[model samples]
Target chain A: QQQVKQSPQSLIVQKGGISIINCAYENTAFDYFPWYQQFPGKGPALLIAIRPDVSEKKEGRFTISFNKSAKQFSLHIMDSQPGDSATYFCAATENSGYSTLTFGKGTMLLVSP
Target chain B: DAGVTQSPTHLIKTRGQQVTLRCSPKSGHDTVSWYQQALGQGPQFIFQYYEEEERQRGNFPDRFSGHQFPNYSSELNVNALLLGDSALYLCASSLTPGKPQHFGDGTRLSIL
Candidate 1:
């Protein structure tokens, strides 16, 4: 079962534009939501994460706006640049060891110069 | 310190063959989990090992198994490989149960 669902399988934006990716989950037990960015040949790197307790978390150009009641969260990248063009994955995990993370299919974001 | 490290960045094997992939967790991390990512798909969990034992597993076949060593390093072994087994195998590490995980570059395995 796909515990989390993401929208816009792919995206393209102009430089300096706002890039948004949305995700929704059916499992309310999920407490930790994290976003990852992956290059073509590398692994996914942690971007920003938000716990259900918080409605929003921001770091630099990345922000996670979470809505606990709606079971949804979205990643926003401000001033999107060419470097920001990569695949983004939103994942949910409740606890640590022995547990698995539920991830969305991923969004391939391309920022044009 | 080095983050999670995986060996043999890329490999190719024939059907019916067996292969072993290895992973060394990041410094201060104690748990290891394995994931498989097919083309254009998100990663799927296989199993997780902590304290030298597999504590949880996903819906995979018996052919996929793993082990954790005393040093928190782990190995994933796939037996009787099939063409469908071709994918990128990833290893994620965390300090303990329920923490956010850090991932390795992954090993791309192609079955012929």
Candidate 2:
């Protein structure tokens, strides 16, 4: 079973527009939610993360909005740029970041110049 | 400081052969974790090593094994390889078992 489910397998957005991706989880044991960005032929890089205690966390133009009660979270990128085009993955883990990660399939985002 | 580094960036093997991949963790890191990522799919955890011992494992089989040296470097060994084993193997390291992990470019293994 896929513990974490992500939506919009792929997305396309214009430069400077808002880009959003959604995810839902079934395991209440999950307390840490992290987003990763991966370019082709490279490893996934940490982007932003949030814990159940917070409803939202923002860094630069990337933001993660988490809902513990609803078991859902979303990533919103403000003013998307061409450089932002890449594959994004949302992952969840237990034991406060000490455990193995359960990842969603991933979303391929494209920002048109 | 150097980030996680993996050796033998690419390899090709036929079925029934065995292969070993190596990894050197980032500076000051002591824990190593391995993952397998198939084409067009997200990476799946293989196992993790800390203090020269296997601390956690995913749902992989015995064919997949690993070792951690005292210096914090790690190696992944696969025995009786199959075509289905073809994938990009990743190595991630953290200062401790629970800290944020830094990943390497990964070793691409193709089985014929």
By DockQ, the best candidate is: 2
Q: What is the DockQ of each candidate?
A: 0.66, 0.83
| All candidates: TM-score | 0.97, 0.99
- List of clashing residue pairs for candidate 2: none
Candidate 2 residue lDDT tens string, B42-105: 8899999999999999999999999999999999999999999999999999999878888899
Which regions of candidate 2 are displaced past 4 Å? none
Q: Chain B, candidate 2: TM?
A: 0.99
Reported per model, the fraction of native interface contacts reproduced equals: 0.68, 0.72
**lDDT tens digits, residue span A51-108, model 2:** 9999999999999999888899999999999999999999999999899888898999
Chain A only: TM-score of every candidate? Answer: 0.96, 0.99
Model 1, residue B109: displacement in angstroms? 0.4
Q: After superposition, how far is residue B1 of candidate 1 from its true place, in Å?
A: 1.3
How displaced is residue B75 in candidate 1, in Å?
Answer: 0.3
For candidate 2, the share of real interface contacts preserved is: 0.72
Residues A1-113, candidate 1: write the lDDT tens digits: 89999978999999999999999999878888999899998988889888888899999999999999999999999999999999999999875312578889999999999
Error of 2 at A59 (Å): 0.1
Predicted structure with the largest TM-score when compared to the true one = 2
